[model samples]
Target: MVEIRTERLLLRPASMDDVPAFHNILSDAAAMQFWSTPPHQDEAETRDWVAAMMAISPGGGEDFVIEQDGRVIGKLGLFQFPEIGFILHRDAWGRGYAREALTPVLDRAFSVHGLACVEADVDPRNAASLRLLHGAGFEETGRASRTWNIGGVWSDSVYLTLRNGQRDVG
Candidate 1:
């Protein structure tokens, strides 16, 4: 099992046990506000999503659950090679958990996986996510208007990239 332990978090592969907590996070309106899809309606939706995630070969595609005090609190992972994404239960936000969870994952991406750079795309209006990425040493690469039609809303995207060893402050 691939697990990365930080001072306050455990980043581990997703499991069937996480579906309920995952569903809770995915279905929370405020938490899903910046996500590509709207809040999931039910557990079945989250179940299928979790099933797919679990099917991926371990460590072949990065998808980790953020656990704190033995409870699933969030997730951070590469959705596609080099493009990272993450989500936390609204209750878990603003406590530096994202940074704590992401820093080591970035290390693994660059050191273990040998990726030269990691990229991210965020809705330009999401100030919190922007700050998190920037605080993690990601530099803005570009921005495009109407780049994503998320939940029927045309959203602009801010692109950022972090080259290996570019910034170590996370």
Candidate 2:
């Protein structure tokens, strides 16, 4: 079901229908460079992820499909801790879809949900993600060594957070 709309986008629950478009983003090398696992080449994996989201809302996340011009470019939304996470097709980067997808979600997280704070954890190496989050009002609170598991290996992680009243780090 579609949940919200921006001037040029649609934010909505992802469907099995989105698997192919979603797969394109997932399979892009540049898009998944910093991802814990390699992107999925098959639609089955994408469907499985979508199924999980349908099963239980993705563990405190309100996952949304970021659609533009009737095409799915990526998935974007709020996860647990009210933090924002999004992955856009490499082709769609730099066009402000990230902000289009995140702004309303952040508003809902702070204003509607009354979340105390929201944050994002980025791999230290993901410069694009860092810039995107910071541009969307996230700040790096600190960095932790050996903090997360990705591709079965522990890696250092960056931690960031946001508070109420629309206050943000960047």
Candidate 3:
């Protein structure tokens, strides 16, 4: 029941009610082009994914649906501890919603959850995601080659991190 409000968005925990919209977003090839897996083929796949996400206990993980004007437009969350990821409907891109949605989530991770730092792994070729991380004050921490076999393609990864106080981690 952790909910956060930004100037233009509401971030709330995902629920079964969000499955349809979640499926729509996840099934978009363009929107999911950089995802670890290909676009979900159908709603059943999304249903299973959302079911698992909704079943996570508090403190184990956090997944929030991004809402604009009461419509679900995307999702953002932590996976295990500090690893973070997000996805937005392609139509919502270039509108600064990702940054707007991520800032407060990072705040909660640092101030509310008391985490020392938050990290993200992005495919190096995903320029928009790399730019988003950098624009949000996360610094590049490392890089790796063929780190992930995403959708059968060997993908390099760029690791970025933001510590409490946005301090550089040595």
Q: Point to the candidate with the largest TM-score.
A: 1
Give TM-scores for every candidate, taking all chains together and pairing residue i with residue i: 0.94, 0.87, 0.93
lDDT of each: 0.88, 0.76, 0.86
Clashing pairs in 3: none
Candidate with best lDDT = 1
lDDT tens digits, residue span 1-170, model 3: 58999989999988888989999999999888879888999899999988887887778777788999999999988866688989999889999998888888877788888899889999888999988888878999999998878678888889998888984212
Angstrom error at residue 148, model 1: 1.8
Off by over 4 Å in 2: 152-154, 166-170
Give candidate 3's whole-model lDDT: 0.86
| Candidate 1: segments with Cα more than 4 A from true spot | 58-60
How do all the candidates rank in terms of lDDT, highest first?
A: 1, 3, 2
